[model samples]
Target: MDHRFEIFLACAPGLEAALASEAKGMGFGPLRPMAGGIAFDGTWRDVWRANLVLRGPARVLARIGGFPAVHLAQLDKRARRFAWGDVLRADQPVRVEATSLRSRIYHEGAIRGRIERAITEELGSPVADDGVRLLVRIEENLVSFSIDTSGGPLHRRGFKQAVGKAPMRETLAALFLRECGYRGTEPVLDPMCGSGTFVIEAAEIACGLAPGRARKFDFERLSGFDPQAWAQMKADAAPHPCDLRFYGSDRDAGAVRMATANAERAGVDHLARFECRSATAIERPDGPAGLVMINPPYGERIGKPGPLYGLHRDVGAALMERFRGWRVGVITTEAGLARATGLPFLPAGRPVAHGSLRVRLYQTGPL
Candidate 1:
């Protein structure tokens, strides 16, 4: 059998273009950008490679099989006939989740129960409350089934355990870096480096390290998984020499320590350095000009707007006075806060949903 399946690369909102670009560069075929992600078609091996190598996507989902079912009885009948044995092991546990939109089968609970019973009865697999998740989407009377190839989101690289207030996810940080024109050649510095996400990601890119190298994925537990092939694929990762170093500084001493330890666990401590310093006190490192990216505190998560304006003003003053010829990328929720920075910012990107609020990246060519 071909075993080629439709794959969806999930990412944060407003980052579909960047994720699509990364997927294209990695040689994924026939890419199409949708509302929240990118869709493509490939075999099981492509799924493994995407989870292992792609840096920007939040997760990888494989559309295993689907059929038209307008009612619960039809859905149950169709679900039983799905080729579950090809992908899921009978001895393993699985969970089924469903969502309905503008379709006749609008009862999600009934949909979940029917599919769950069908899989259990047909495949002889035990149903668990929490394990490998099978997603079912019913829209306009058409039902589709997909499996989460990534158990947890891809952002959990399994390295950093400690996080500061309002930590930026690794996947989001990677996309933001790409948006700022970072190609792993130049140095990157995060002034408010909560958990050292940006710096460590940049260093890993500079050293040519696979983002999923030190982590485990849900695909390993699926059927037809070849351990030897996966071992060879992971072993092919060769770390290159990085001439430039990445830097991160935070005012909190504990955050600095956590960032350092996280970098050590990521195996890029040699290329990244962490220190404790406020944003206004930060100085440019002794090297060629690179990118300065910061995910500072905003009103949504941190203090009120009044004090934050001064903080933004101070950060702008420090950068404008000391760091010349360097590019800047600031992520914030309020345009007023970004305006407080007084730096000559070019057009801002689309607002992305981050937790409960929307944020955007304000960029500048050179300061």
Candidate 2:
């Protein structure tokens, strides 16, 4: 049964427009953009497709059901009345979490206990740590539930076993690429590619490879999951030929090796090339003009030493001198470090949450 429900595609702060565009490109919409995500209508099959194809969203949550509850008694009664067999199984464990805001049931612990008892009593199942997660939210005296269908964060992508310090996530890389107006038609170069995230993502896009193709998900453990249909979906995602090759250059030879190995693991090594060279030595590639994207250290992930400014300046000088007609994107935590590039960046975007520090995407038009 293709029962329709709300699916929220959550993303990093300040990049909802880009994620919406990606969904629209994939033929999903009239979407509503919220504070941290986009909400749309879909069924289990749509959920599966979303988990399989989309690259920008960090998590895919299915809003299943909810009701108004002014007190714990009402919450317990309504929770027990809901049929858990339709969604969860009785043989396995299920994890329940809750949050509350502007509601009478403000205590999260009490809310969790009531819901847990209701589920255990109704479904005859135990609540364990590693069980299927059910998020219960009490907002304004109403309780709602959502299933984290993706299990782990979507950025894992089941590849890139090796990484350097302060590495960029695959989901963020894909969204940043979209925010920079990239559609995978031309080449892409990452001068500071730590593990070749941008280059590999670009290559996969150009070849039409699904990001979640190689990964497993939590939805498979739920009831009514059709293994045969999911297999067919994965089998149908055929990769197209991409003549354009993506490039990544790093001063660390170890980073170069790690990137090459990661590309191979991601099945895009043939279309991606990694070079162990300084950023100042990186020149524009042959053929069509494309993008120059980099995430340089600005004391956020590592120390912001004095030479960091010189490194940005030298990289900026190299791109300015060698790469004419190419656009650029630099992600940094501080505006001063971005200014050190001296590139004509467009107005800065809102600060994005990158671990402890928030960073912004500094983009430029064709130079």
Off by more than 4 A, model 2: none
How much lDDT does each candidate structure score?
A: 0.91, 0.91
Model 1: which residue pairs collide?
none
Count of backbone clashes, every candidate in sequence: 0, 0
Candidate 2: which pairs clash?
A: none
Q: lDDT of candidate 1?
A: 0.91
Which consecutive 10 residues in model 2 have the weakest lDDT in total? 298-307
Please give the RMSD to the true structure for each candidate, in Å: 1.1, 1.0
Q: What does candidate 1's lDDT look like per residue over 221-261, in tens digits?
A: 78998999989888886678888899999999999999999
Question: Which digits, one per residue and each the tens of the lDDT, describe model 2 over residues 101-171?
Answer: 99999999999999899989999878999888899999999889998989889999978899998899999
